[model samples]
Each structure stands twice: as C-alpha cells, then as structure tokens.
Target chain A: MELFALSDVPEVREGDDLAAIVEDRVDLRADDVLCVASTVVSKADGRTVNLDDVTAGDRARAIAERLEAITGEAKDPRFAQVVLEESNDLVMEAPFILSETRFGHITVNAGIDRSNVPEADLLLLPEDPTGSAERLHEELGVPVVVTDTCGRPFRHGQRGVAIGWAGMPASRDWRGETDRDGRELGVTVESVVDELAAASNLLAGEGDGGTPFVVVREFDFGDHGGSDNLFREYDDDLIRQALQAWEFPG
Target chain B: MELFALSDVPEVREGDDLAAIVEDRVDLRADDVLCVASTVVSKADGRTVNLDDVTAGDRARAIAERLEAITGEAKDPRFAQVVLEESNDLVMEAPFILSETRFGHITVNAGIDRSNVPEADLLLLPEDPTGSAERLHEELGVPVVVTDTCGRPFRHGQRGVAIGWAGMPASRDWRGETDRDGRELGVTVESVVDELAAASNLLAGEGDGGTPFVVVREFDFGDHGGSDNLFREYDDDLIRQALQAWEFPG
Candidate 1:
C-alpha cells in the first residue's frame, strides 16, 4: 500500500467542488482509496460558527461557569452553547467537555475546531461525514474515507480515525477465520477504514502545513467477510455507560 | 509512503534471529520502518505457555467461575490464571478480563494469543516489547515497532497499535505549533507510531494467511518535537479512573 497527498490544494470554500479538484490534480486509479480530512469537508459544507452569533442558554452558561471555576481560567459560554447544540450527549464535564456528536462520534467539544480556519471563528465537523464521503465517492469512482484526528481514552496524542466512509466496508471480519495452526482467530474483526485513515495521516500533517486529501494505492482488501457497523451504541459501549453513572471527583 | 510485506517468512521458532531473517530477505534502508507483529516476536523470545502446566489458584478459579456465569460458556481457570499472572492490574473483572499489562498496555487477557502458535497452547505478549524492538533496531539500523491488534472502547472492531517501539519517539508534539491562521493549535500531539502500526495492518491480515512483517518505505517523521509517552497512566486517563470505581452492573 502506498499513500501520497495531493499537493497545493487551495483553501476550500462553501459549495466547493471536491471531486473536480481531485480530478484536475491527478488521475485517480480504480484501486485507489481517497482519504479526505473533515476540516476541509466542513469548510466546504459551510459548517462554520461565529462565537458572537451564538446565544448561550442557562445550561451552557452553567457548564461554562463550572468549567471556568474548575480550571481557574476564563471559559466562553457561547462556545459551550455551540458544543451543546452540535452534540447528542456529553461524556465528560469538568476538566473538558467530552461530547458525543449528533452523528455519534465522541470527542472534545464535539470536534469543533478553534484554529486553521481563516474565514470563521470555529469550524464544526461535517454534519454527516458518511454522506459527504458518498458524494465524493460517486464523483471520484473510488472508496472514500472521511478522516478526523482526536485523542482517545487510555492513549496520549491523537491519530486519524474514520468518522465516515463510503464504497467500502468499515471492517474485515475474521471471526471464524483460522490461524496458521487452524485454530480460530481471536481477533474477530479488523477495522480497515480507520487504519487507512491513520495511514493517510502519515502523509497529511496538521495545521497550515497540512494536506487535506490523501490517495492510497495498491491496498487490496483481499478475500474476507465485510461489515459496516463501526460506531457502538449505548448498550454496545460499556465505558460510556460507566461514565454516565460515575462522577468526576472534583 | 509505501508498505509491502516480505513474502514467505518461515514460521518463527524460539531463539530465531529476526533481524537476520529480514536481513537475508531484503536490504534494509535508513528510512525504512520494520513493523513486526508481537505474536512472532513472542514466539522468537519463547514467550509461550502450556495450559496443562498452569496451576489455577483460588483467585483465578473464582474469576473464571464469574466469567463462565456471565458468558454462559465454559471458561478455563488455567487461561484466567495466565491472564492474571501477565497483568499488573485488572481493569474489568466481569464480562471479560480487561487488564493493564505489566508494560502499561491495557487490553483484554493481557494480549495472550490462543491461535497462530504451533508449538505452545498460549502465546503471551513480549515481556518487554520496547526491549525487543530495540534489539531489532540495533541490528537493522532502522526504526522498529512491535505491534499488537486489539479491540478498544467505543469502536466495534480491532485495529493495530504499537505496544513497543524503538529508534523513534512515539508521538509528534504539535503543542506550541501554529495553525494556518497563526493561532496556537488546539491539538497538542499527534501519535505517529500508533498511526504507523494501524497503517501497517492494512497489509498484515489476522489469520493463517496473514503477513507478520510489513516494511514501510519513504515514510518521514519530519521536523517536529517528539515525545516518547504512549500509554496513559491512571491520573492522566479519566476513563480508567471511572472504570476503577464502576462495575459491569450485571
């Protein structure tokens, strides 16, 4: 597998043609998989917010006040309001607001970006990343994975993860597959899109110097059963349940 | 960057010189990264166990009984004993044994493998994965990452992660880096090693036909501040604390 980023992708604006940009840049092969950063996707989708435009409600103000007091730093209620509006649930409250976006991706502040946007004060993640990928997949004629970088629990630093994907299954199921000795494999499924996203991150760095689009070539999925269920729901996720019942010992 | 697996790697035996095996197969480059699966590393290091030889104590037996009841399947006390001995702390006791290995990696069953081992009943993770990587790094003159595939919370499937790495820092520190707007970035760090591991897994499949060694070529670490910390300690991880205080509620 080889990954290379598209060079000199101009700043994306609202209603920009992503497929046309890629088509004009290079000839994409049938075997190639495209990994696009969510920041550009959101920017193109006009998912920007001005903190001044948001009106903080009672709950947002209350959360901001508590956050400010806990950290001994100023907190913006308007920012908290934007997070609340974008999220379906909040995973953590005090030190930082770990939120579950309306689309079910859990991350800090619902994955709202504070920097790298030249046009807006905040850049929200693409409303439906999978849908965005599908539109690109239809135009590009290849698999597309929408990538985001976020910190995960029990690990330091952020790496790329697939928030949305199209034209491919999220995982390669190895549940009943036999190992070298013909014994059943312990690893039931391998999440491929997320792995592809992480691989793309090796070429696509962060910030002003970052590349928003990456092309992965010669990555064959081979013969394997496929599954598309990536995100875990309430019952499927135990950590989320644990967090729901426990309180931070502030 | 490109990745290709070394074809026809013979089944690794105890005391096998992995660096020699790779040196024989292909020429090593200064910019190449060798990602070796921990299963092969453990096998080469004789980190295997026989279930018949293990004596399950009261703690292991009690833990096994609870697991058997919850899972409604016959559970082996000897297997539980192995997990207990390999782990430094038990993060979850019921439903499954989520353990923090002595090396600080948190995974189910301390990352023991029941499949893929031709000589033993079980294959434990490398006693010191970093040391193992360092040994390979010293001989090959290239960065080496000892990898393991495991399931994580909030995600439905497994992906590759670096349990041990040598000759390079685990993360690219973007702490004080500025974004396009010259505003300090919110993302403090980017975990590059884990991303490398995940990328390598695209070629390293999970079963009998799986390729254990993947070579990543032309990958650049670039000019960035680096940090070696990968695993999250107790205080640094809020989810770990929550799990320590909460139970499965079964």
Candidate 2:
C-alpha cells in the first residue's frame, strides 16, 4: 500500500465544507482511503468551544485548584470545566483528568484539543466521529477515517487511532484462519483503520505541519465493517474494569 | 511522507544479514526510514523455537487446561510453554496469557509467532529490538524501526508498534511546542516511530501477506532518543499498577 499526506489544506472554519476543500487538493479514487484528523473534522462540525463562555462548576474548579496546587503550574478553570462537560465519566483527577468521552474513548482531558484553534477556543472531538466519516465518505465517494491522537495505557507516546471510519473494515478478524504453516491463527484480528491512521501520522505530524488529509491506497479488505464494531463495550474494557474496581472514588 | 512495501523480500533464514537484504531491495537515503516487521527480524535473528523440544512445565500445563476448559477449544500446551519462557511477567491467564515480555511490551502470548515458520516452530521476539535497529542503522546508514503487531488495552484488534528503533527519535516531545494558533501543546509527545510502524501496517496485514518491509520517506524528526527511552518502567505504568492492585492475584 502507499500513503501520503495531501498538501495545501487551508485552516478550517466552523461549517466549512471539508469534502469540497479535500476534493480541491486530493484526487479522488474508488479504492483510496482518506484519513482526516479529528481536529479538522471537529472544526468543520463547529465543535470548537470558547473557554470564556465556559463556567467552571464546583467540581471543575476543585479539580483545577488541586492540579495547580500539586504541580505549581497555572491551571485554567474554564479548561477544566470544558473537560468535565465533555467527559462521560471521570476516571482520575490527580495528575490529569483521565476520563471517558461520550464516545467511550478513554483519554486525558476528554479529547479536548487546544491546538490549531483561535485564541481562547478549544476543539472537542466530533460529536459523532463515525457519522462524520460517513458524511465525508458520501461526499467524496471514497473510504474515510476520522482519527485522533491519544496516549495508550502502557506505551509512552501518542499515535492516531480511528475514532470514526467508513467504507472499510475497522478490523479484520483472522480467528480460525490458517497461518503460513496451516496452523489455526490465534488473536490475530488486525485493526487496519487504526494502522492507516497511525501511518498517516508519518506525514501529519503533531506540529502545525498544515497537512491534515492523508490518502491511503492499496489497502486490501474483503468487506467493510462499520467503525462502531471496533469499540469494546464499557463493561468489557480491562482498564476500565480495574479502575472502577479500585476503592478510590471518581 | 510516502510508504510502500518492499517488492522482493525472500523468506528469511536464521542468521541472515537482514540489513544487507533490505539494502538490496530498498534505495538507501539520509531522511528515509525503514520499518521492519519483528516477524522478519526474529526469523533472521534465529529466534524461532521448536515446540518439539519444549516440555510443558506444570504451570504451562495448568494454564492450558484452564483455557481449554473455559473456552471448550483445544489449547496447545507447547505454545503456552514457550510463551511462559519468553515473558518477564505474566499479567493475566484467562482467555489468554497477557504478559509483559522482556522487551517491555505488554502483549498477548508474549509476542510469539506460530505463523510463517516450519511446523512445530515458533518465533519469539528478538533478543534486543532496539539493538537490532541500531545494528541495521549502522550498516544501512538510515533510520530503522523494528515493529510488531499488538493489541491495546481498550481498543479492539491489533496495530503495529515500534519494538525497537534507531537513527531517529522514538518519540517527538512536542509538549512545549507551539501549534499553528501559537498555543503551547499539552501532552502531545508523539511516538513517531510507532506511528510509522502503524502506518506501515496499511501494507503489512497480519495474514500470509508477503509485504513486511515498508520504506517511509519524508518523515521529519530532529534527533535520536533511542527506542528504549520510550518504554515506561513497570512500576510507573498506569495499567500495570491498576492490574497489580486488583483483588485477584496474578
């Protein structure tokens, strides 16, 4: 397969038709998979929230004060309020508020993005990343993946994952498939969309590198499994189970 | 950045000079990065262990029996024995053995491979993945990343991660870097090597797809941090801490 980032994607604004912008720079193909950053998708969906309008409730204020008191760093109460507002459940509140987003993603700060937005505005994850990807897939008549960056449980650095996807299987299950030696495969279900997202990161660096759209070609899959199929139910997550089992309260 | 699988990588044998083989297929360049699958690296490094020589110890036998009884599926005692031998710590043994390998990777079955090898042979992770990357870097004079497929804590399906890397920073610490909007980035230290590895998966699917070596060009990073630097200490890992704190014993 071949992967490359699209160039000249202008700074997106709320309600901007991103598919039109992408069509201007990217040559559409039936087999190509378009990987778009969640930040840009959120921007197009008007997911940006102004910190000035955010009212820090008691919990948000308490959390912010605790963070500032512990780290001796400035903590924005409004930012904390936004994080709390976006989160479905607070997993931790000490070093950072490790919370579960409404989308069931476990991320620090509830995927509240502070970069690449106007002053005092924060970009939240798209209300429905899968729906966003579907819309782009419809508009462009190609596969699309909406990606976000997050730190993993044990790994040290962040990589992009498919928060939303269309026109491709998010994962390919090889459970009973035979290996090269004709042995039944074990635990080899491959997450192709996340890999595509991560691969796109090679060009879409975390910095203001300006390139937000990535075109992936030659990815082979028999059928498309909706992106929602990739998510584990809340009760089945190992970390969430362990965290909830803890004596500490959220 | 551009990424594509190598066209002509033969079935690797033990003690083969992989860097030399890669050089024959890939055009070397100063800024280019090569992502080598751990399967190929393990095969080249003679890490393939024959199951015929392995005797299932008591613990391995017990674990295998428990798994078979639970799932009502046949379990390979010899496979379980090899996984036990290769792991540094056994994290869980229910549906499968979730162990931390000596390489500090938390994966199922200790990153063992039963595929792409002769019958009754298994491929273990390289002795030192970072060292292998460094050796390749010294010989080929290009950035190299040793990658493996792994399952994440929350996400379903597997994606590639950097098991070892050289000649480039495993992660780019962009936490203090300014974004396009001139806002300081928070928690944006990106694992670029892992991203590249994940990106490579677009071509390197887990089945008998022959594409293992991925050539990546135009990836930008300033300095090298060594792959070992990205590993979080066992004690400091959030998931490990939570898992160990569980009421159930390992």
Candidate 3:
C-alpha cells in the first residue's frame, strides 16, 4: 500500500468545504481510501464548543477538582463540564476521566480535543461520523474514514482509530477460513479501518503536522462495506464486567 | 510512507536465518523500518511448544475450566496451561484470560497462536523482543520492529503493537514542544513504532496470508533510539488500578 498526505491544505475553519479543498489539493483515484482527521471534520461541521460559554455543573466541578488533584489535567472546570455534556457516561474519574460518548466510543474526555484548534474552544467528534463519512464518500466518489487518536488500555502511547468509515468493511473476518497449514482460524478478524488510520499517522504527525488528509492506494480489500461491525456494544463487552467489579479498597 | 510485503519469503521454520532470507528477498535501505511478525521470530528461535509435552497445572486447569465455560475459547486444558506458562501474571479469569507477559505485553492467550502452525504446537512470542529487534537491527543495518496483534480494551477488534523495537524511538516525545499555533503540546507523544506495526498490517494479513515481513520506507523520526519508553510500568498505570478494582460480583 502507498500513503501520501495532502501537501498544501490551509488551516480549516467552520463551514469549510472539505471535499472541494481535498479534491483541489490531491489527485484522487478510484481505489483510494481517504483518511481525514476527525478534528477537521468537526471544524467543517461547526462542532467547536467554546469553554467560556460552558458552566461547570456540580458533578463536573467535583470531577474536575478530583482530576486536577490527581493528574493535574484539567486547569478549568469548564473543560471538564464540556466533556460531560458530550459524554453518555463517565466511565472513570480518578487518574483520568474516561467517557463513553454517544457515538458508542469509549474514550478520554468524550473525544473532545483542545489541540490544533482555537485556544478558547474544544472540538468534539462529528455529531455522526458514519454520516459524515457517507457524505464525504458521496462527494469524493471513493471510500473515506474519519479517524481520531486515543490512549489504549495496555500500550503506553496512542494510535489512530477509525471513528467513522464508509465504502469498506472495517474488519476482514476469517473465522471459518483455514490457514496455510490447514488449521481453522479462530477469532482472527483484521481491523482494516483502524490500521488505515494508524498508517495515515505516518504523515499525520501528532503536533504541527499539517498533513491531516491521507490517500492510501493499492490496498486490495476486494469487496467490503461499512465499519459498523467494528464496535462492540457496552453490554457485550468485558470492560463492563471489569467496571462492575471495581471496588476501591481503603 | 511506502509499504510492501515480501512476496518471495519461503515458509519459515525453526533455526532458519530469517535476516539472510529477508535480505535475499528484498533490498534494505538506511531509513527503512522492517516489521517482522513475532511468530516468525519465535519460529526462528524454536519457541514453539507442544501440547503433549505440557501438563495442565491446577491453576491452569481451573482457569481453563472458567474460560471454557465463559467464552468457549479453550478447546483443551493444555492451551490454557501453555498461556499460563508464557505469562508473568494472570490478570483476569472471566470472559478472557489476560496475560501479562514478561516482555510487559498485556495480551489475550499470552500472545500464543495455534493458527498457521504445525498441528498440536503453539507459537509463542519471541523470548526477548527488544533483544531480538536489536540483533536484527545490527544484522539488517536498518530499524527493526517486532510486531504482534493484540486486542484493545475499548475497540472491538485487535491492532498491531510493537512488542520490541530498535533504531528509532518507540514514541516521539513532543512534550513541551510548540504546535504550529505556538501552543505547547501536552502529553502529545506520538507512538511511532506502534503506528508502523499497525501500518505493516496493511500488507500482513492476520490469517495464513504468508506475508510476514513488511518494509516501511520514507518515514522520518528525526533522531531516535529504542522502545523502552513504550512500556508503562505496572505501578504507574491506571489499568493496574482498574484491575485492582476488579471484584467480580457473586
């Protein structure tokens, strides 16, 4: 597979026509998979929330205070409150606040990003990433994957994940398929969308790396569709059991 | 960045000179990062273990019974016993067995694989991935990252992770570094090695695809060293706290 980031893309703002900008900047091909940073999509969708306009609720204030005392992460309670407004549930509150977002994403701070945006505002994930991807796919006439970076449970650093995707299956399921040794494969589904997101980061640097739009070519997915299957419902996941099992001993 | 898997690699076996085989198959350059599947490394190092030789210990048998009852994963008690032998600690026993390997990797089944192997044998991760990476780096004269697929806590499917790496920093520490907008990046260290691992998966299919070695070119790390920092200490991690909080309800 070949990956290249858009070389000349200007700072994105609200209501920007991203499809036009990307088409103008990069040469598109039929089989290319376009990967866009979720921040840019949020900006185009006018999803920015200003902290100054947010007032921390009692819960947000208490959580923010505890977070600040423990990890020194939240300097302003409004930020924590904004995170709360964007979240479906507060998964954790001590070391860091892990929020389960309405999009069924379990991430830190409800995927509210403060970096690479206006200082006073936080950029929440697109209201509907799959919809955004579908719209972009229609406009661009190719596959599109909306991506974001999040910390993982075991690994120390973050890698990109596909928050929204269209025109390709997020995973390649080889459940009943046999391997070269004729052994039946067990639970060996490949998460293709997340891998594409991580590959895009080779050019989409974490900071000041202007290349947010990546075009991946020559990846033969053969026949594929949407990323809906990549998400495990909260009730079906073991993390729920782990959370219910949580008992902070004195 | 450009990626391509070697199309000419023969079926690897124990005691094969993998570096020589890879060098013979593909040309390596200075700036390239070679990501080899840990299975191949294990195969080269003769790390495969047979079920017939392993007798399930009491803990393994009990854990195997619990896992089999919960997820129907462990077909035999020996599989569970092999996983236990490969792990530093048994982090969990319900739904799945999360093993903390000696190499600081928290993965399911202790990174053991029964697929694509000789029947009745299980493939384990390399004994020392960092040392293996270091040796490969010296032999190939290029950056080497040993990769394995592991399930993430939040995501439904697994992604490739760097178990051992050399030649560049596993994480690009941009802490205190200014963004394009002159904002200081906070905890924005990019995990380059892990990204490469994920990128390599574009060519390295999960099941019986035969393409185990991937060469990633044109990626720049500026200046770097090893993958030591990619591992978070058990004491300094929140997952530990989460695991400690795990008190299974009756």
* Full candidate order by TM-score, most accurate first: 1, 3, 2
User: Which residue pairs collide in model 2, if any?
Assistant: A199-B199
Candidate 3, A176: how far from true, in Å?
Answer: 2.1
Q: What is the DockQ of candidate 3?
A: 0.66
Q: Tens digits of per-residue lDDT for model 2 on B183-210? A: 7775467888888888777577676667
Angstrom error of the Cα, residue B23, model 3: value is 1.0
Query: Rank order by DockQ, top first?
Result: 1, 3, 2
- Grade the docking of candidate 1: high
State the lDDT of candidate 1 residue by residue for A203-244, as single tens digits: 888867768899999899988999999988988898888887
**Local error of candidate 2 at residue B174 (angstroms):** 2.1
**Chain A vs. native, model 2, TM-score:** 0.92
lDDT of 1 at B58: 97
Q: Cα miss at B49, model 2 (Å)? A: 2.3
Docking class of 2: medium
Task: Kindly state the number of residue pairs that clash in model 2.
Answer: 1
Report the error of model 3 at residue A94, Å: 1.6
The window of 10 residues in a row where model 1 chain A has the poorest summed lDDT is A201-210
lDDT of 3 by residue, B103-184 (tens): 8888888988877776347888898999999999999999899998878776677778889998777887767666558776
